[model samples]
Target: DLDLSGTVGAMLRSTGGTSAPIFGFGIVDTATDVKVTLNDTNAFMVKGSVTEADLGFDNFRFGIDDNAPRMIFEDFGGTTWQLDSNGNNFRFFQAGSVKMQLASDGDLSLENNNLDNVGVIFLKQQASADADVPAYGQIWTKTATPNQLWFTPDGGVDTQLDHTGAFPTTWSDTGITGAELETLSDTSDADSLHSHSNHGASHGNTLDEAYDEGGAGAGRTITVDDGSPIELIAAGPTTKVIDILQSGGGFPELQLRPDGILFGPGGGTPQDISLTRSGNNVLALGASDKLTLDKIGATTGDVLAVQSTLKLAKPLVLDKGTSANIDGNDEISIPVVTWLYLTSAGATDNLDGIGAGTEGQVVFLTVVAGKDITLVHNGTVTAGKKLMINGEATVTLDQDHDFAIAIYDATATVWNVLVPGSGGGVGNHNILDGSVHQDSVADGVTAGSVIIGNDTPKWDELVISIPGANILNVLGIANGETVPSWKSVLDGTNPAATAATASPGTSLISAHRDHVHPIGVGTTRGDILIWNSTPVASRLVAKTAGAYVGGDGTDVVSTIPKRTIVLTAAGGKEATTAGCAAAAVVEAGTNDVDYWVLDFDKDTDEFAFWNIVMPGNYDGGTITFRVYWTAASGSGTVVWNLKGRSYADSAAIDQAYTDVGETSTDTLITAGDVHISPESAVVTLNGSPAGGEYVQIKVNRDISEDTLTADARLLAIEIEYTTDAISDAI
Candidate 1:
């Protein structure tokens, strides 16, 4: 590899000899920094140089052996300068027509120079790998003039021009002219102009002159000769005749003049001819000559005349020689003719053999029996054709009649009349006899009453007269009950033997049976009427009178009555305490009575009373009590209490002693060995407790003032009761 780092300027020269000096430079150390210079003093290198004393070499060659020869200047610090393979400065020189050259497989473009002096130049090369080639497969060329660079084919076959002339040499010659064409022609006679046939002038005639000359001898001309004969004849006695000879069995030819006249074959002579026109063109014919016999009776002389009469045997035949007489009878008679008569004839007349009547006389001709008479009138009958009747002749319809008359409208088409009556006017009444009815009687009839049997007249059957009676009253009485009355016979009888009485009272009332009576006033009361009256005065009075009343004044009590009771003591003494008191008691022989009278404010009274008494502490004392009550009927004892008390002494009661004495004093209340105890002393007063003096008494009673009570007490008293006789004897 070559590594170029610095610039160097140097020159090397080769001296000339017969062998032509050659100079070659090679890179010794490709890795060194070296730059070959052209001259030492110039500071730039030339590839090869010339010295002062010798002619230097004209060409120099340089090369390097490194893989990349361009690496020699890759690191040079200064501006880049291009170098050759030996690292020598590149140069150019030209001497006369020879020049130093450089070439490459790619483009060689010169910069900044107009290359003018060279006459012609060319470049040849194969296309590179990257080049685009056109479809025509051209080769690249570099020429100096005209197209500077182009591609062309290698051969002389230029496909761009016409190939009429000789190719290759002629194509390459730029100065060739038309005279070269004659030299290329052939000179042999067989190849000259006369050798080919002249087809252009072979058939020389034109189409118009050919057809004109060919048509000259064809048959379309007319000629006449001097020896043609002429004859004159007339169509009638005054007509003219001429003969026309037709050759070749065709119609004779005639020519028309420019003056609008026609001439026949005899030229300018008068001929027996007739003038007729076919379409708009006129034609002339010879009068006596028959061109064709269309029918057998047609002759050459049978031409028509002006006033001649033609008579046929029957109607259209000629020369049959039959005779007919139209005589004075105003009838044309022919022999044994079967004629159809179109007029009506009477029923008895024969139409076939009728005698002739006087002229203008009306005659009747009869037709055979059972044939219809057809009357044909040419003109309308003005007053209408009437079959006039004389005397009493009538036109009666024997069976069913079918009278059909044809009527017409404005367009004259006939229509039949179908009305039931006689058809009136034209077209107005097409319905003939349409309103006539065959049966003209009325539909039904009515008569008077129809009766079945006869009966004797009775009073009920006789019509009776009542004052101010109408048909409604009669109908009411007819449906009424028939009752006998006392005025008839034995019940106030009528002298008439068979009499039925009309009872006034039992008879049917007019208002009851009559429909004309007002409904509510006369008829049986309906449910609605009875229902309307039921809740009024009658029901009101019943409801009010029967309704319950409260108690009366006399049956009520004014005040509640009260009963009073007055308490009375047995000794006629009163207790100091008004209410119940413990000290109150009854005396020994007296009794206390509590009045318990019952008082009732109403009619009845009730009373209930109870009392309880407690005994005192009196040993052996007896007390007696009794309770009694008085009621309205009687009095009865209710309860009793008795008690007795024995004291220690009777005088102890009066003495002012501290203690009651025993023994002679007989102290009922004693205190023997008087021992006082601490606890309560309980003296159970059971049955009747004994009475005692100076006794501790406790009475318990659960009783109100209104309740009964008993007296119980303990007391010290002397027994002093004695009978009357015993006290006397003592």
Candidate 2:
């Protein structure tokens, strides 16, 4: 709202210091923003994190969007820099001309000074194929045939030069004739061959016979036998090596010897494997005696199909393994060993992956100690590392005695996991059935010791079976309990017979200990009580209303229900006196959820009154109130600062009240919200709260200091007090 007072112009004068603002709204802290406070020079400065600071207060955004224009930066030392949009591209301009542009597809373009071109210029000219010929004696390159250097020798026609980028052009100015080059090609190797390029190798006539390591070549042949041994290779009379090698890995190199068989690593020492060829098979050694490897079929793929059965009399060793702690990533570098012991977590260790494996290789890992391992199935993808565990079913080795078995699938570059029972994995449990693994496991606690137990984690219901009929007797004597003394006077074999020898006293002692029998003194039958023979069981039932009494037969009779008074806004009304602002009750919602809304404004203090009549069974104690409310609109912190004037009777209704009573502050995190505050701390009712009397509660929204930007719609209030009986008549 504005009133200009009918003046020809409008001007604002600062009422206080230079920092005082003349006009603004929606105040905030000064770090991110500041008001337009004018100074004596009156430069009219306002720089914030926005194009204009006034827009954000009205729910409008302040940053770059569809409404903002291009930003420009000017330098007094030289020119200007601008950031603007070029179609869908972002463009940067220097000195009113485009300098750079970035496309949306991530392509960048740098521009030159010329408006038509976008490149730099050197001393010599770089011309295109469609470009005009250069000036006299000037060297230039054509874009289409750039490798061919050209120059205007006489300022008219271009002189052709070599097309290659290598130094000293292929054609020399002191040219040799084709007839002379042909004579050099056939007859000379080093004589014309630093020489071989200008002529061919058969006396240089052909380029085909010139030899390097690239392709299969034509060569000279020499024949030699043992008696006529000739020098096959020599390196200028010095000792040198001549190697016969395959080009790369996976290609095999074979050497044939007529009389000897060698077994050794390359470049090291060679030894003879002490075996002789028997009847179409290799000689006997280890379990692989007379080992014969045969192919399955032409259609079947195999690493090496062993058609012969192999058996070993001695125990096969798995690995020379010790307990090794894995890394934080649960990774370990597994050697070519067949077994690994992964246990006793040092710091943080849980196996997730292994490294270094070959095709068809089996591995067994012992997962023990306290740390459990959850496999990251199908995940062992680190650079240069080649071990992964992939399985259709999830596996977790959680017990202290568990082992994992897997085989490397080098084709898929993943390890195919397997269950323990299918292989020779000596774990202490069975994977096929939930049975205890009775294998002798090496005890990690003591080196070289074997331990056997049922360490598998299985806890199903256990049932015991008996062989005979129902004639089993139990010696039912509890620890620290004694048998009754009068039981000794009865027939020792048949205590069930009429024991009129004298009835046993109530203080019967245990069969073993001299402790007295403990019981609670209550008479009710269905009620439960604690053991209380002076000092016994210490357990008390929580009573809400009635107390425990010794009923017939010393039974406990306790009650457990708290009496509550729930007040709704439909039962409340505004104050009827003058000079008091009151809230109006409005009905809200349909069948979904209906609330009798008592509106409390956020600017002024509004009051609502409700008078509650106590039941005759009321315990005459202090009462507490729990209020439920919702916001009308907007989201912010809300303060429910209300004090109840609980005056019953004989007091003036217009008397002054206390400054502040019960206060609760909360937030409407989701804009329109509902909240139920916890019960207010011990609000004592006025004039000795008793039966048949009324206590009037006056509630007001103390919104003079609250930040809630909207009205607070009250839903309901709960008034809770103690009760000793069920009804007023009692």
Candidate 3:
């Protein structure tokens, strides 16, 4: 081997010439392009001084094959170097392994998942990029919002690099790293121990300068933009899910993952958030969402909320959802997050339950006037639709002006009423901010609605002004004390009752509760009247005693005046066997006219019991029932004994009957004749009978005292009791 420079010595003979050069065969080219060719299985090589040296010797070779060209350099050592041009691509090989490739389409590919060996050096560009795109734009597009770095920028206005962008090598080969990214920096030194001329300070990957306070690289903000979501996975390498954990110190962290956005308190217990969709949940059973439906097994749609309160600002409005009876039943339903615009029908409308309710949900309900809706506490309104209001059953939304509030309980799966609904627009006011007049009281103020001074949390005094100051003077009153009278206002010496004569009052008087005006009108004698429907404009009906105010079933209630009510024996239950009074029927002609009766055997002395709820209108007194029965065959005097007990709410249901019953003797005048017995003396109830309480009355016949040989077919019994109202409060 000879090393010669600046000398025309012959080492290679020109293949294009017929003759060789003297001294040494060499080829020289004066043309603009020159070519070197080696046939197959031949190589232009350089080797150590060894005879007949093969590829195993320390040598380097520039070889050619069928449409392939490669240059290999080896020193009898491992993984030297090789550059090959085959498959129309440029590849660098180390130890016969492809380390990097420059594709024909101008892409530089590194075959690794990490750039750990790469160092922060001068950025370079790929000139083969598409003409319209920026240099290295093909790879930079992956990072839509590229990261910025200050690897080793020279400070000053005339610095070569702007230091506005960075070259950050990620864990994937598709990401470009060595690109000459633009960056902005005052001073930076890329060397491990060198100082920058601009700042005279050293900064590198060393621990001493890594987190220097107030340094360019210290406490800098890193912006992670939203593109194809950035995911925070495990510290180790894996595409599968593995929890990113803290040291169990209970630090809060939010992370993006395959499942969804997860939030973990600490110790690796990350929770996925569930977002709501418009349609009903169609998630599979045991899926993260729709877990509430899986829990309660309810087919009705509901909202599952994990938070406590849903607050809204003032003037808050919502789409009014509808609520009505379910298929003519007493049950109803309205989605959780909504206000109810309710409509109802029925003489005694009942709202026993609400459906489609979720745990920790609140509901508001309203009813119009005359639409009586009673929410029964512990009512029998089927499963998945149950409620309890104040532990009592009188929760009725009686008016339209009022609304009810309720909360749902998952464990009990029932709505617990917070504010009981009172139908008919007659409940506590839903107060809002407003002003009320506090001026001196006037005469005309007693007619229409007005605001007045009252105390509230936000105001000193403000409330609804009830026009009732002088209501008694103008209110319809009967002749005696019922309606207003001219004598009430005219005072003494006022003329007697005359149809249309007016006797004006001598002096004015301040209105008082008992101040009845002596007007020139009269009314009927009965309990005060109550409106059955919304009052018509200026429609004045004279006060009548026929209709009294009552909140029970929809019916015009009236004062009994006689203090007596009659009930037949058919409404009572019979005892068993010897003491049981059985029901018997009688058929007359061929058409079979049917008539029902209670037959008490003369030999057994059977008894019939009547379970009664003393009407709300019942005035408390001794309740006496007479047995109306008939003789089927033989007849004699019949002795009927009455005994019973009353059981109020919470009273012992099995209380014993009265010690001694009142006995009445009635003799049968003729066979098959209806006999009347004297009213038995008032029999005392064991539980101290009272109005609106439950009473069980048992009537029996004494066989020893009665000579009736045949069965006594009892027709009916008349119960005598007094009522002070139309009916019990509904």
Q: What is the number of backbone collisions in each predicted candidate, taken in the order shown? A: 61, 22, 38
Best by lDDT: 3
**Worst lDDT 10-window in candidate 2:** 194-203
The TM-score that candidate 2 achieves is 0.27
Candidate 3 lDDT, tens digit per residue, 111-139? 65344656554334322223333222222
Tens digit of per-residue lDDT, candidate 2, span 682-706: 6665555676566677676767656
Q: On a 0 to 1 TM-score scale, where does candidate 1 land against the true structure?
A: 0.10
Q: Which ten residues in a row have the lowest lDDT in candidate 1?
A: 189-198
- Model 2, stretches more than 4 Å misplaced? 1-535, 538-545, 548-561, 577-594, 641-660, 728-730
Quote the RMSD, in angstroms, for model 1.
Answer: 53.4
Maximum-TM-score candidate:
2
On lDDT, the stronger of 2 and 3 is 3
lDDT of each: 0.25, 0.48, 0.51
| Candidate 3 residue-pair clash tally | 38
